[model samples]
Target: MSELFDRHQAVLPKWLAIYYSDPLEITHGEGRYVWGADGRRYLDFFGGILTTMTAHALPEVTKAIAEQAGKILHTSTVYLSRPMVELAEQVAELSGIPDARVFFTPSGTEANDAALLLATAYRGSNQILAMRNSYHGRSFSAVGITGNKGWAPTSLSPLKTLYVHGGMRSRGPFAHLPDDEFIAACVADLEDVLGQTRPGVAALIAEPVQGIGGFTSPPDGLYAAFREVLDRHGILWIADEVQTGWGRTGDHFWGWQAHAENGPPDLMTFAKGIGNGMSIGGVVARAEIMNCLDSNSISTFGGSPVTMAAGLANVAYLLENDLQGNARQVGGRLIERLRSGCAGLPGVREVRGRGLMIGIELVKPGTDEADPEGAAAVLEAAREGGLLIGKGGGHNTSALRVTPPLSLTQEEADEGAEILLRALGGG
Candidate 1:
């Protein structure tokens, strides 16, 4: 074994290694490529789980951070900061919710926690409705509401929550129902839960495009229907855009906007791409929601000047360079290529998702069910072939998630697709 590996095995906590067991050691990254300790460069298709929107070590973002670092770094929320205000205003404008109030946090989990707190205060309800296969965050309350079983171990007793079915097609418990029937069943489930549970139902949280859950996109008209149900139940709608936000979807500046024709969410949480890997996350709520949390809510490092500067620069870069447009164009091309390239490949289940957030599901030759080993093999093969991708789904089953940076070039997308195709063939 290498000396570094021996040292890591000796000194690093066993629990930490168990969480991230990958053996590869990456030393540096630039653009869509990361260099390993062995000096091999690999094309990164995951884009840091969709966080590196502007690409690795983007010059403008780095410059902004450096400039801000030299000037001043931290400023408590008790006092106003220029960068914070600027970034808040820019985010509000970009979201098309001009009067939206922004609350920054250091992580997406914090942002979701904040949003949940605000929602509870606003509606005076303890009940929250979330979709199955959804992942909000790992925090206590967020995890409680998250529908994934993996998070169940974290919570002592999952809070008062109701699970609604979402995605392209509703099945399992939702098998007998048609599309409209499934939606109605979901709404009825929420209403029934609200009626049976405690009086106040705080919020109905959902991802416009479910991230960790195989990149599942909600069925058409589902958002609007869910919004109507929430309104009828006097609950707020929280859009968990932590993974889908910041122009990753290409059609809109915010993920919720893609479903605006349905109904805009009352509270939207953003992270991942907002700071372009600078550890910034936030919640944007309607002014009414902000009003409810005035006295009780607070954060020590929520909106630091340096974090705001990085976020501001990232947003500015996205706008100035029209990276969202690039995401749309390139994402379309990539999706088309994948669909065409693997049209006849056995065990290729489906290609789903929007813009740059794509998922290629792999299954047995004759069925649409998952094949986890096949998926792992594909990922490993792709990595060996100098490309890095990510796996998703509840069991980490065969779903290759392609969330490359918005700046990914057409050639790069084509190469990634080719590599993925070759990996699938090996499987």
Candidate 2:
């Protein structure tokens, strides 16, 4: 172990310093727990930023990957692979997007980038409308739609993107308006922007439930109204489901499904939970929009048989066991427990989120501004108590993002909540 650590230390890249690493190196993971180099175990609540929905080292998914890897790995999309076709068919069927065409990519960033490019190509537009505080991805085109400035440094030129504040804070471009008025203003603002930059507006992209943007859920009727406006303007609505899709939200397989009654988007992008930690992503488009693309776009490693097999197995597990229902049940219990546990803690401001994708917002004692120190204390206490967690939101503000795997037991949820409550007490 010492020799292996020495080798890794010698070759590890300096760019990785941006991430905080624990001294106890992780050696293996199973279900919702990860074991360290010292063989100590810790309960994982973040689930690899909500990627490992079915859990780690899941038997069926592993077996599928191993079996497919032994038979075949890569075949360009020019030719067909059974796993790829099957996975695409399954995704389409589950999403209720009939005969929907799927395009594979190596990451969610690529998926979002492809969606943006396709929107531009289909509409011949160069401008995109995205929500403030939303995170799409890091690639150039995806970065253009991402509202976080921290993700803007990689772009060579300023992004041709328009931004609107979602319903959360009260002082932004769309503030000082009632919910109905705010939605109408947003739609009008978008139309005004498009008129000024006429014929160049490609698409309006947003997360159904904003993830990196502090887990903010928009007010009722917002998405439906936005869909109508986009349709009127001949613009496409792209649902960036990278972080919120694949049953993370509990009630729906896709985050947008939670809003399906409102209206569906033209294109949807997925990653994270679909592959269960395997690097795979895909775009599901309405037949008409997909057919317009002329087949010029292709990826070399997009839908390799091995990754597709893993995705198929993950989806199978989700369906066969009714994991989405489990997410709802377990997530409801966890949310209620969290809200009740931290209801009156000092420096704790709000508890919000749907299903298991919960967030506990920490604020300074007297100000609405974030309480980073209080958040750090809570995180430290939770870590010391043998639970692994993560933080998110702009300004590195206080949000303890809790998204445990679907397989996490109720007992584990109780323990996790108890630890979090104790951590809040420390703050």
Candidate 3:
């Protein structure tokens, strides 16, 4: 480790994981590339874990933030703010929830916490149903609902959370079953879990595509089937869209739309990519659910003028340019290329994803056993080839996460795939 890495370790918590055997300090970024402190430019495929929604250093977003900062940075959530209102209006319209209300927070962790608060309060229960191998956030309440053990440091929580099966379809009990039978089995599992729980179950929260759990997901309409059961008990469905939102999935604007059979989610939490790198997260809920809390609450730095301005500009750019269509077109090509390139690689187990949020799982050669070390080796090789990537999975970070900015072009996609293939030692 360099002096900077050594200093980072001295100051930061050990649990805050850093990538690679050696760490690089990224100083600046433009478009699809970022320069390290050593001044080497590397293609940014992960986009700061998909926080950079449109592009890096986008002129429109930068100008909006600068202009807003010049006027007023923040006025808290108490008094009215124009930029806040504008962004809120846009988000509410796109939320797909009827009579939707938006409350901004600083990060996805806080957004999930707020959703939990609202659901528990509205439904009058402290019990929550969460999907196994799922990850929400790092906060106390968020960790409580999170089912991924690697992310959850402590078991203590205010709510009673029960883990449900069928979140990750690849390595679960129903992985071998057909799509219809898999959904049925998962629904049956959910019914059994519900039967074991008390009547105080407030809501069931899920990630349409499990982000930190290696981008794994169950079949389409699985949640809709689960929704059928939750409806009988009045359990609200909360879609955690921290990673799956903003049309990154290609086919849908929101991840929950994959299960559109039961209609929109009762509550949805969004963060990460909305501000295009700024701290902006929020919960969208129907009027009655949002207005359930009787007392006043506020996020001290949430929805500030600067972040809201950035969000407005970023969202506008995303829509006007039709980046979602770009994701569908370019992402489809990239995944196809990857699938073709890594066909017989020894460690490569599966290549799966929708749109730009793709994952390539690695196993111990021909066995089903996870190979985290192999995944790490591939990461190191990709870095040497000047391509940046991320890794995550339920089994010790055993998969590569390839979530570039939604504005990723075909040429860039091909370049990244070539580098990744070389790193995997594929010919």
Candidate 4:
């Protein structure tokens, strides 16, 4: 083991998971590549779970940060911040919620926490509905709504959460059903669960693509159908877009747009990519719900000028360059390439996800049992081949996660896929 690894184990909590058995220390990054401390260059497919939305070392974001730092690094939320208001206006416009208001946080966990607070307070209930196999965040409130057992370290929660089905399509009771039938089954199940809950269930929170649950997602319009039921009960719908937002999905700017027929969600939380590796996360809600809180609250570092500056520049670059369009064109090709390449591999179970956020599920050769060992081996082999990937699942860690920066190119995609294919024993 390396000295740093030994020291990490000695000082850090054992539960703070590290990626590889021999963990990596990435010191610097440029474009789609990041360098380990020992000077090994690796193609970064996961991009810190898709936090680096645009290319690394993009001059626009770096310059913005530098300029803002030169002026003032931080000013707490008590005073009006120009960059923060500008960013809020842009996000509020993109949010699609009528009369939208935005609240910033330093990370997605706090963003989701704030969303929960607004929702529960507005409806006067601590009851929340979540999806099975979903992973929200690590906070006490966020984990309470998270359905993945491996990520939830605590059973004690402030809110009463109900776990509903339909996040995973590979092995659920509805898995064998056709698309329409599957949607019906999940809706039926959701209705059944809501039937048992008390009158004041606040909201049904979901990740359009379940990030740490291995990028599992339901068919399009599934949430729209659920929205109908939620509307009947006056329960709000909160979309957690931490790993799925900001055009990563290619076809849409927000994952909930996949279910546009029912209109925008009552609340939405986003992070990871908005600030292009800067610490930025936020919640957007209609004015009515956002103003429900009676007490005054502030986020000291949430919308600080520096982070907001990064957000503004990053967003401008994304829009000006049409990186979402790039994700659509290149991501489509990459997924098809992976699906076609891994089709005959006995250890491969399914290739799933939309646009830049993709997952390859590993299974036993002829059975549906999760092959976490196989996934781990593939990850290691990919690293040896000068590529970096990630592993995640509901509890088994049986899936390979591919969430590259939105600026990924056709060449990078092809290169990463070739390395991944070799690692998976396909080449």
Candidate 5:
């Protein structure tokens, strides 16, 4: 092991996972590529778990951060923050919630936690409904609602979290059904779960695309169907758009738009991409629900000037360049290229996703069993071939996640696809 790896192992928590047998030390990055400590450059397909929204070292974002740092770095929420308010205004307008109120947090976990606090306090209930195979964040409250056991380390929670069905469309009992039937079955499952729960459930939290659960998602209108039931029960719907926000999904600006039959969600939480690589997460809610919390709350570093400046510039860059459109055009071609290449690969179980958020599931050649080892091997091999990717799944982390930056170009997509195919033994 390298000296840095040895030091990391000694200092970091044992449960913190690192990629590859010989872990890479990324020294710097530019555009869609990153340079390792040893001066080797690789195409960054995963984009730092989809956090690098625009690109590596984006000029606009870097300038914004630097400018803000030159003036001020840290000012607690007690003071007036122009950048924070400006970014919040942009987010509130973009968020479809009417009369939306935005509260910034440091990360997606804190955003979800704040949402939970608002829901429970507003409805006066500790009961929450979370979809199976869903992952929200790593906080105590967030993990409590996490249905994937691999990430949920503790069962203890302040709220009564019920695991709802319909997050995963495949490998479940309902996977055999057609899309329409699958929707009906999942709605029925939701109804049954709601029937068993007590009165006054606070909210139902869900990711439009289950990010850490290997980018798996229900049908387009699944959440819309659930919204009808939630409305009847007066349970709020909180869309966790941490990974699927900012047009990453291509088809819709927000993943919730795929299921927009009823309207926007009651509450929404976002993080990851808004500030590019900066730490910025937040919850947006309608005025009434947001004002429900009687006690005053504040996030010390949630809306730091530098991060908010970064967010403003990053969002502006994303909108001005229409990165969402780029994601649609390039990602559509990339998925088709991947599908065509994997058609004859027996170990490939399924190729699924929307826009740039794609998943390639691996299984034993002739069986339906997950092949996590195969996924890991492909990851290492891809790195060896001058490409970087990531893996995740509810089933033993057997799915390869292919979420490149929204600014990924056609040439980069094709090149990365070729490298990935070779890693999968299909090139």
Candidate 6:
């Protein structure tokens, strides 16, 4: 093992996952590429778990961070903060919730935890509805509602979490049905689960696109239909947009918008991509729901000026450049190209996802079983071919995740696609 890898293994938790059998240490990055400690440049397709929303080392974000750091680093929520208030205002205006309020956190786990707190408090119930095969976060509160067995470490939790269906559209009992019928079946399943549960279920939290579950998503309008049932029960809808937010999904600004017939979610949690690399996460909710917490609460490092400045610049650049349009146009072509390339590869089961977030599922040559070893092989081969990617799924970890920065260009997309195709053992 490399010296750094040995040190990391010695210090970090053994369960903390790292990619590849031989982990490569990235030294620096620029644009859509990164350089490893060995001084080799590689195209970055995963964008550091999609946190680098814009290109790597974006000048605007770096400048903002530097400027903010030159000034005061933090003032805490105990005092008034201009950057915090400004970013919160921007988030509230964009959140689509009526009379919205915002609270920032340092990571998505904490953001989801805070959302759970708000929902349970607002509705006076500790029961939460979460989708099966979903990966929320690692915090105790977040993990309590996580349905992915691999990600959920312990059964012990503060809340009683009930697993629901409809997150994973493929490989389910209803997968053979048409989109409309599939949605109906999932809705029926939801109703059935609700019927068995006691009254006052606090809320139903979901990721419109299951991020860690290989970018899986339900049929369009499924959540809208579920909204009707949830409304009757007085349960809030919390959209976990940690991966699918901020136009990463191309067709919609937020993933929940894909299912928007009844309107915006009651509460939304976002983390990844907002700060372009800086640590920033938060929850946006209607004012009434937000104010439900009677006691005082604050996140000490949540809205620090440095991170807020980075977020402000990152969001502004994302909007001004119309990166969402770029994602739509470039990502459309990239997925099509990948689909064509994988058509004849027996080991390649599927090429799926929208916008800059894509996934490639591997399987045993002629079997339907998940081929995690194949996924690992492709990760190693992609690295050897000068491409950086990621992988995730349920406990099997059988799908390769391709979430490049929204600012990815046509040239970069083609280059990364070719590398990935070759790595997949396809021409």
RMSD of each: 2.5, 2.7, 0.8, 0.8, 0.7, 0.7
Best by lDDT: 5
Candidate 3 per-residue C-alpha lDDT over 12-100 given as tens digits, one digit per residue, 9 for 90 to 100:
99989899888978998998888999879999999999899899999999999999899987799888889999999999999899999
What's the TM-score of every candidate structure? 0.92, 0.92, 0.99, 0.99, 0.99, 0.99
- Per-residue CA lDDT of model 1 for 274-315, tens digit only, reads 898898899888897877765655567888888889898888
Question: What TM-score would you give candidate 6 relative to the actual structure?
Answer: 0.99
Candidate 6 lDDT over residue span 61-91, tens digit each = 9999999999999888999999999999999
| Sequence-dependent TM-score of model 2 | 0.92
- Quantify all predictions' global Cα lDDT against the true fold: 0.80, 0.79, 0.93, 0.93, 0.94, 0.93
Regions of candidate 6 where Cα sits further than 4 Å from its true position: none
Off by over 4 Å in 1: 1-22, 155-158, 168-185, 294-297
Least well predicted 10-residue stretch by lDDT in candidate 5: 293-302
Cα lDDT of candidate 4 equals 0.93
Expressed as tens digits, the lDDT of each residue in 1-427 for candidate 2 is: 3665567678996443221334446788999998867677889998777888898999999999999989988897878788888988888877667568888898999998888878877887677888877789777777767777655556453347877656354436666678788878877776677677756567888898777766776665677777776777787888888988878778777777755665667899999888998989988988877778776756889988899999999989988988878888888899999888777776777787877788788888877788767777777788778887777766465677888998777899999888888878832
Cα lDDT of candidate 3 equals 0.93
Worst 10 residues of 6 by lDDT: 163-172
Supply candidate 5's per-residue lDDT for 394.
Answer: 95
Clashes of 2: 0
Off by over 4 Å in 2: 1-24, 154-159, 167-182
* Residue 127, candidate 5: C-alpha displacement in angstroms: 0.5
lDDT (10s digit) by residue, model 4, range 1-427: 7999999999999899788878899999999999998789999999887899998898999999999999999889999899999999999998999999999999999999999999999999999999999988899999899899989989999999998888887678899998899999999999999888778799999999999999999999899999999999999999999999999999999999999898999999999999989999999999999999999999999998999999999999999999989999899999999999999999999999889999999999998899999999999999999999898998599999998999998999999999999999997
RMSD of candidate 6 to the truth, in angstroms, is 0.7
**1 or 6, which is superior by TM-score?**
6
